[model samples]
Target chain A: MKKNLSEDFSMEDSLEQIIQEKNLVYRPTRLMTGATLSYCPGCGHGTIHRLIMEVVEEMGIQAETIGVSPVGCAVLAYDFMDVDFTEAAHGRAPAVATGIKRLWPDKYVFTYQGDGDLAAIGTAETIHACNRGEQICIFFVNNGIYGMTGGQMAPTTLEGMVSSTTPYGRNVEQMGPPLKITELVAQLAGTYYVSRQSIHKAATVRKAKKAIRKAFEVQKEKKGMAFVEFVSNCNSGWKMTPNEANQWMEDHMFPFYPLGDIKVDGKLVKNVIQDL
Target chain B: MAKVRGAIVVDIERCKGCEVCVVNCPTDVIAMSKDVNSKGYHYAYMEHPDDCTGCTNCAIVCPDGAITVYRIKN
Candidate 1:
């Protein structure tokens, strides 16, 4: 007589299955299951989203994580990020996140905001939040132009950059120089860590993930404030395919912004790529 | 001994096919499949199963929890 061995077999199998899936869902796939993403083909939004989830899982804080969404393509962050999320006013993700953190100081708060939100309308809020030394992390995604708002020029748009607003290329005399957020934030004494990284290339993406992970660690330790600005590609706005955006960033933007850390722990940590 | 074929399968029905795993695979063993899955998004696939060294790079960077790797032991 055989005692149905199904129970014993399934128990081990299900556990192993969870282990197998762990590689994919490091923090237990928080992304809402739906049809394919609405993003255009080859956009950097997907890459940055993945990086955030991977970083969240690695830190084992998915349960304690809360995200503040912005009004750009990042507005959909609440859908992709499986954790609790709240949308912020046009460019006030930092301020919105500050409120959430104040209410629940033990939680990890992150704002997934775009260049428009981080560098323009939300600039004052972002700057003041940093000044206040809020124990939160900001994931500032700078793709140069505004993706969700129809390829308009953003404050982070490089000088002479062409966009819906600047069809003839942005002239420094008229538009002023591009906003370098990492450099600007590095000046703030409240910022405990500030790194400017990219997702255009393979090696650079790896570094960006590490920087994000470190930011999460800072949040876990309740470090004053941490900011990692990702120089991501806006393929939809740039009118180039995703691969082209990556190539463009590697060729053009790398020279202007370069790659590496601007500040950490009151001292400057160098970007290794810049040395080479 | 068998050639120890280890194929990387991405559960597209289960996959958001975000392309994170495709770019993160250290060995470059996986690439987006031309044929879209049931979800209508191109899922990652191992083209050269022979070249896969059982490293599971595809599994590691997958943000959607969709990849499954089989290591066939003789």
Candidate 2:
């Protein structure tokens, strides 16, 4: 049953208030409905989390889907998202997701991990999971440093950035070099799709939304392992405002970790999800 | 006589306490409360509704669509 409103008791002339109540460009969103997040004011995690949630909500998969979260600040991610989510051991999300997804093949399983988790400790799980060609979605958030436990140098840390662990800046002689996650993941034969996108600007956000949706679609079709590593920012951990952090990423990070698709199965065809 | 009927009302449950309302409001009538609601979203209220001046900037910026302010003549 639909509710309709009749003419109100009060009638106004041409001076009535005008409202642009329809065709909204975007809404705040309902996916992030719990605790006042502890994320710093300018962190990109919030925005990426919100985008993923919105996609899940729109896809109506939250009810049947379960997410494997990492031990980083994103460990509490399950609280922010409405989907049925499980907290994985630090850097073990890919393995956890692989196990759960195999058991409950009908359910949508995705792993949300950070740079430290994905590129460092869980590197084997991630590489092998994608190598084995498991059917699942992996949303890798690369913020360039350890965010939750403290700002420490991460595997994805750039060449000359100072972190709590590397104050003098990462020296290749000692630290080797920053790992390019997307490029590394692309080398895996099992991964069917891979793209690196960010949620910083509107255009990038739109593309990221689409790419995320595509990854889910690939999983739905059982194509193979799908991965999306968003070059997100950690304004708080990096000690910068939202705008400042975005600028830093564009100026410094983007050059080191350029954004785009590293691999894809060009032959497989399916209906493209509008927003993804 | 012109009646003061136009005012935006916020749905406290849906407000995420993001303060987009407080920050985006042109007239600056919206404010987030330190108290928590049942759903746990921070409740936003009309502190200086008088200063609204019929502007819907608060409603427009709300990501949750948790506000409804309108003018009604009786």
Candidate 1 — which residues are off by over 4 angstroms? A1-35, A270-276, B1-6, B13-44, B54-74
Candidate 1 on B1-74: residue-level lDDT in tens?
22323556666675655566666666667777888877587767776554555555555444344665655433
Candidate of highest TM-score: 1
Estimate TM-scores for all models: 0.80, 0.74
Q: DockQ (Cα-based) per candidate?
A: 0.20, 0.11
Task: Report the error of model 1 at residue A114, Å.
Answer: 0.4
Q: What root-mean-square deviation over C-alphas does model 2 reach?
A: 8.0
> Could you tell me the TM-score of chain B in model 1?
0.74
Give lDDT tens digits, candidate 2, residues A1-276.
633323232333312432234322334467667555556644566667777787888888878888888888788888787888998887888888889988998888999989989999998998889889889999999999998878999988888898999999989899888887667667677889988897666567778888888888888888889999999878767887556777789999888777877677732232222211
Docking class of 1: incorrect
Clashing pairs in 2: A10-B73, A28-B63, A210-A276, B8-B69
List the global CA lDDT of all models. 0.73, 0.74
DockQ, candidate no. 2: 0.11
* Docking verdict class for candidate 2: incorrect
